[model samples]
Target: MGAKMLAEAMGMKALLYANWERLELAEVPEPQPKTGEVLIRVGHVGICGSELECVVQRHPRRKPPLIMGHEFAGTVVALGEGVANLSVGQKVAVNPFVVCHTCRWCRLGKSNICERRQLMSMHRPGAFAEFVAVPAENCHPLPDHADTRLGAMVEPVANAVHAVRLTGQVLPKRVVVFGAGPIGLVCAQVAKAMGAGFVVVVEIAPERLAVARQFADAVINPAETDFLTEVQALTDGEGFDLALDAVGRSQTRRMAVDAVHPTGVAVWVGLHDDETSLSGMGIVYGEKRVQGSYAYTDDDFAMALQLVVGGRVEVASWVQEFPLDEGVEVFWQLARGEARHIVKALLRP
Candidate 1:
């Protein structure tokens, strides 16, 4: 039978991004795998902050009338032809970013920046439904001892892994991360895990700062304290060895650079605004390295899976679970900033 016929027989429901600020829950054809692909019965899908930007029409490349969930975990239900390694019923996580292996960037071993890369929800349908089909290579099997729900966390944590990895060798003795959201918190935890002597998190939200306190060496609220002064006090005026800005705003981006020592490294991981300004003279004089860390590399992805599977990182502390049917409401709530304490959200279809 065809895909539409199979979906009708199975009765699948999907949430589609119909238009800006508009999402519709509809019964759609269950996706069937083609050659070298596999069908996954989605167990959990993470709602990314970038998706929230999509809803508000802030993301430059995101177009409407598509399925939007990318970070997800599921069980393999069926394998397409030529796919022999992944067995049905195996738990897995989706990498979401599919690259054309023939691209120059791919040939250079920088597939994360492949010129022809296609991402789920950006170039193809995604896992915001009861079922999703992806290339067999995109599925990473989760360990039998790991929590399947945590599979949804791999992509996000992988982002942090890539960011921290960009900072180079010699782990910082004191690290300062701006923003206490999901990415910020993960960056702090990853720094601590990598043996950073001290990890400090800066945020304006009290609720988020409260959660930041759970894993960071110090959580400072810029709303209540003089942020630069406090950071100086914490580092004894020498400045942090490494600074990460996960917020990506002008002010926080400036803070990420300013809070670091003369030769310290600063990495920007968030994708909020297109334009930001900094002092070129200061950058030249201070000899600071400011780098932009994009999506994770293949090795970073595998390491992220290990991080989650080993229970070294706790995601439940920040995620708020919701049924797939509530995806529309969840998007609106997050867009309006009403879901305060929910640093991350997962949709279980």
Candidate 2:
């Protein structure tokens, strides 16, 4: 305890987003848990695809000179005043969205879209350091059998959980997911977990498609063949019961709109493109439903944790772990698409 306390008094190593395309590895003062917050000793922090936008100064909410990690898991080191549920040394995964409970959206049970939502990396310092402070209510206890590496995946899995839940009353029997990236793969898996009968993944990258084939019933490479023809052949021209756009490209969005059956649903989970054109009459005449899913609700987060802790979801196959000091180079590699073989990267502090 004395040594741990001494280490806390001394500065800890942290990777700081100093500027666009710039990250600095420096020793910074240790963070203390404020009221209703818990100080966690970070075990692992996964890099998000959206963080690339933050690094390039494109994300609207995230600014520079920040600690940019949100998908993370750790052990509770200290509990702040007024926090009683968590204890020291309890392993937990974090839900990074800190919302204002007073907002109308929050009051309506849609806190994921809270008007005053403050994400950990975007609004406050995050877990790219040895320690991070988060609201005690955001922590979910992981089972003893669960690895912290897999625990770090709970957040992204929760994203998929929320996206699939947005389909509204229709549980997809035949589903097509556009893109085989991290989110896309997880979306397919969660759809299967949620009882989708058939799931197909579409991707241009052979490596990613091969990985997606592990979880999906089928995989299609759109670069070599016609995706629409293949999808039509699979469903006998009925179109998919559900279509999800996990790659936020104009082409993928269009594919989603075209692939879903009449009166079916299309969910847009990716945010790559801000503006896309869809046929107005096509939507009206076909009675197709399109919805956008952002982050996850508290119940979704809890269910995600349960999935990981219960060994129902597996992420160890596609994740690559690196030291926290190597985050800058890893971030650049991910941004440049150099690490195409791996699905996601984790920074271990």
Q: What TM-score, computed on C-alpha atoms, does each candidate reach?
A: 0.96, 0.96
Candidate 1's residue-wise lDDT over 1-349, tens digit each?
A: 9966765577588988887778889887777789999999999999889888877874657787788888998999999999998999999988999999898889988889999899998898998999999999999999897655799999899999899988886688999999989899888988887779999999999888889999998988888888889988999889999998999898898888989989888899888877899988777899999999998877788888988888777787678889999988887899899989678989999
- How displaced is residue 244 in candidate 2, in Å? 1.3
Model 1 scores a TM of 0.96
Clashes of 2: 0
> Which lDDT tens digits does candidate 2 get at residues 1-349?
6976975687888988887678888888899889999999999999999997667755657778888899999999999999999999899999999999889999998999999898999999988999998999999998887767988999999999899888865677999999988889888988888889999999988889888989999888888988889988989889998988899988899889888988988899999888999997889999998888899998899988887677566688888999998988888888887888668999999
Candidate 2: the clashing residue pairs are none
Candidate 1 regions with alpha-carbon error over 4 angstroms:
1-11, 58-60
Between which residue pairs do clashes occur in model 1?
none
Query: Candidate 1 at residue 44, lDDT?
Result: 94
Off by over 4 Å in 2: 1-9, 57-60
